[model samples]
Target: MPQVNLLPLPLIASTRAASNAIPGRRLRRFPGLYRWLLPAALLALWQAATSQHWIAAQVLPSPYEVWLTLDYLATSGDLWLNTAASVQRVVAGFAIGSLIGLVLGGAMGLSPTLRAYLQPSFNALVQIPVLGWFPFALLIFGIGEPLKYALIAHAALVPVTLGTMQAFRQAPQPLIEVARVNGFGRRQIISAVVLPAAVPVLFSAFRLAFTKAWLSLVVVELIASSEGLGYLIVYGRQLFQLDLVMASVVVVGAIGWLIDRGFTLAEGRLLRHRLTPGARP
Candidate 1:
């Protein structure tokens, strides 16, 4: 035969069409561009409900009213003060908990005997919700800043411990063996092989721990605090100022979202080497 083509003409045409379908495919490639769609729709619905009197104004303030209340809080300086206090507690707790978790998890991962001895107790303890520890924490810490620190620390510790241990356990055996074969010492192997491989998991663990710590701080503030974002929410509800309550809620969510985005950016910067070429950060 002078020429032969195995593929069908329709299949080749369809493949070319898919390759050239930029306008139709751009949305799928960059879905993040559409994230605001749902929020915008919800806001429109909320405004409509408020204008139509479908929901009582007293029960659910308009978004504009909530914005006004947020402005007042900001200008009066209560918002910054509460936010700073919460951030302080989260920082202190997360630092202490992450240190302890790293040490414990490293020990367990390195020693089978240690893991066997501690795993059961750790598992049992983690099953109890952070709120369940509140009474004991209150009794021990006396409803002070220490109480918030302790609860946030507890919330942070579990995820970090689990993540570290799993990272160690799942580290590739071949790489570790190669390190040893190349005359690497224990420290060298850990620094060059183990830690590098575990970076992604460790970052994820830190993110989870940070979230847990923040949430625990809010709960503790709500239950027993003189000041913090959580206290603002409680105070607003107590005064039946739905606008204040909504404002505080909005601020809390926005802060959490910003913090998460910050972490994601940091992760992308620190772990860019692990990402494939041309991938989105």
Candidate 2:
């Protein structure tokens, strides 16, 4: 039997037209424009708020004032010095923590007995807030670089370990089977099959670990450092310079955003060939 149209011609045309327009209407297709809209709106609102005096200047300085303060800090090299210190600390801590996490997580993931033994204590220990470790760390490290590094490393370790464990455990079974069919040894199977499959998740873990390390850098500096963005914030507060504080905050946020964006771009490039056309991994 011949199939008949279920709708009128105009209705069909309209539906087709709407479907055709859908691609053009998708906001994510223009991600840069979409992403900037909110920030632009917020900036405008901030300008309005300050100009209209809706908020007191003492509490929240004008954006212009913050910009001026940021300019002054940059000119004086204070911003760069503090930012470099923070970055160095974050890099050192993240490297140490992530390396340890990968080793420990890999061992535990490969050996169920090891995981069973460590999982409970590991989970319990991670439950304590980063700040909760402060007293002990302070007593042991004495408000120095070691304390900052230890705390930052502690912050970075948990996520990377969990992510690495999950990544190893979740490697595609089909690939593992294929490797086994070829009589690949355990090490070869892991290196050739599991490692490639786990790259995406591992990258995510590293990104998260870096974020934690960066945040912990600020926290540690806030508690006991002479120089860093967090210390800059403290200095501004002590001097009652809201503009300076705001500038420091903006710099911190901007730097974190830039670094995270770099990671995201690198991940995209690294995994580009793995994804099918029009499909996300």
Cα lDDT tens digits for candidate 2, 34-105: 778899999999999999999998988999999899999999999999999999898999988998999988
- For residue 89, give model 1's deviation from the true position in Å: 0.7
Candidate 2's TM-score: 0.88
Q: Cα lDDT for residue 29, model 2?
A: 73
RMSD of each: 6.4, 5.9
All candidates' TM-scores? Answer: 0.87, 0.88
lDDT of each: 0.90, 0.90
lDDT of 2: 0.90
Q: lDDT score of model 1? A: 0.90
Please give the lDDT score at residue 63 for candidate 1.
Answer: 90
Query: Candidate 1: how large is its RMSD?
Result: 6.4
